[model samples]
Target: MVDPSPESVELARFSLWRSKLDCAFGWFEDAERTIESLLSPQAQNQPETLPFMIFIEPHLPRMEGLELLHLLRSHPSTQALPVVMFATSYDETDAARSRAAGASDYIVKPVDAREFMQVVSDTVARWLPVGSKKAD
Candidate 1:
């Protein structure tokens, strides 16, 4: 769930809708916005009540985004969260850099529905905690 601009939000939203896997996705234009919402009590309740996988797009400008990712991966609470990056091309050096930072996976954008669903299914299968399950 990596999206920084409104256009990115739209793209991710569309990709998510087209996915055949049962999952949950949320977006924020910036890191601070995502943090604020995620820190709230409502967000805390989500893990227990809804029991869905989370995909976050901190979407900070390159440097800032990297900083945010570092912070998240270093922080005790979110360090092991199942995060991934998405972009126009998987060839970008920066995407690899992001993986080095902490992303569990990365996806190339303009994803066809089939490939997109495959990625979603694969991520869920790999990341969802043992004994916990998603309805889809």
Candidate 2:
């Protein structure tokens, strides 16, 4: 769920970074508009789905979207979903506050390819079901 810029190149790069997974993309012009869409009825009911790890770009235009993390955490339907936020920069205090607000984790942007891969892999690994094994 780590949405960078809407650039296709960025999306492709991210896709390539985790090519082995059954990855799908969800888009919303704003986070608030997308929460329900991303967590559609079908998606929520999937039995084999992995723990959701969202990478949100909080720097964009919609401030309400930023409130999405709190809203998701507050709602029972999405309360346990693991979310990871990505941003180019944030004041340390601001980042700390975001954590307090309920983001599972945060990643600073301009991430190198290697680090990006590792982070995504590690996050997915940590969040995956306990008896599950990594996809080959």
Please report the candidate that would top TM-score against the real structure: 2
Instruction: Give the best candidate by lDDT.
Output: 2
Q: After superposition, how far is residue 90 of candidate 2 from its true place, in Å?
A: 4.4
Model 2, TM vs. native? 0.69
Instruction: Write one digit per residue (lDDT tens) for candidate 2, span 86-131.
Output: 6667558657767888887776654565665565566666665565
Residue 129 of model 2 has an lDDT of 54
lDDT per residue, candidate 1, 1-136, as tens digits? 5456566556455645564344566666667765556545676556543323444443456435566677667755567676766555555676777889987776664457556555655666677667655455
lDDT score for candidate 1 against the true structure: 0.59
Model 1 clash pairs are 1-57
Clash tally for model 1: 1
